[model samples]
Target: MGPEWIVVGIIAVAVLFGAKKIPDIARNVGRAQG
Candidate 1:
């Protein structure tokens, strides 16, 4: 994809999950992968 798509995806994630929730989401993702 393009840089514009990346920006849209980030914004969508922030809107759907909230800015404060991202770190917790990442932590869970990492734990799952481990």
Candidate 2:
């Protein structure tokens, strides 16, 4: 794979993880409050 593809893959993984974590963090906070 080229360097460009590697960079794209890293960004994709970061985006996916960020998207997944936001909801999970909100849920955890909600549970803590309640």
Candidate 3:
């Protein structure tokens, strides 16, 4: 994929996952994995 596609994907992830919720999910997943 191109850089444009990467940007779009990032925007899509931010919208779908959300800025506030993503960090919490990441932290939870990190804790579980670690």
Candidate 4:
């Protein structure tokens, strides 16, 4: 259930945000994590 929900959430995010901006968003998230 947990992993499936995570996959679904990722798909939802990709659909909502579009593929082009994903890398940049991920980079920003990585920076925030650090």
Tell me, by lDDT, which candidate is best. 1
Candidate lDDT scores, in order, read 0.93, 0.76, 0.84, 0.91
Show model 3 residue runs off by greater than 4 Å.
22-34
Number of the predicted model whose TM-score against the real structure is largest: 4
The predicted structure with the larger TM-score, 2 or 4, is 4
Ranking by TM-score: 4, 1, 3, 2
Q: Residues 1-34, candidate 3: write the lDDT tens digits.
A: 8899978976887799998887887688799999
Clashing pairs in 1: none
Please write out the lDDT profile of model 1 over residues 1-34, one tens digit for every residue: 9899989997999899999999998899899999
Model 2 error, position 14 (Å): 0.6
| Model 3, CA-based lDDT | 0.84
Model 4 agreement with the true structure over 1-34: per-residue lDDT tens digits: 7799988987998999998988998999999999
Please write out the lDDT profile of model 2 over residues 1-34, one tens digit for every residue.
8899978975786687786676776678799999
lDDT of 4: 0.91
TM-score against native, each model? 0.62, 0.47, 0.53, 0.82
Residue pairs of candidate 2 with colliding backbone atoms: none
Candidate 1's displacement at residue 12, Å, is 2.0
Root-mean-square deviation of every model: 1.9, 9.3, 3.3, 1.1
Rank all candidate structures by their lDDT, best first, as comma-separated numbers: 1, 4, 3, 2
Model 1: runs farther than 4 Å from truth?
Answer: 1-8
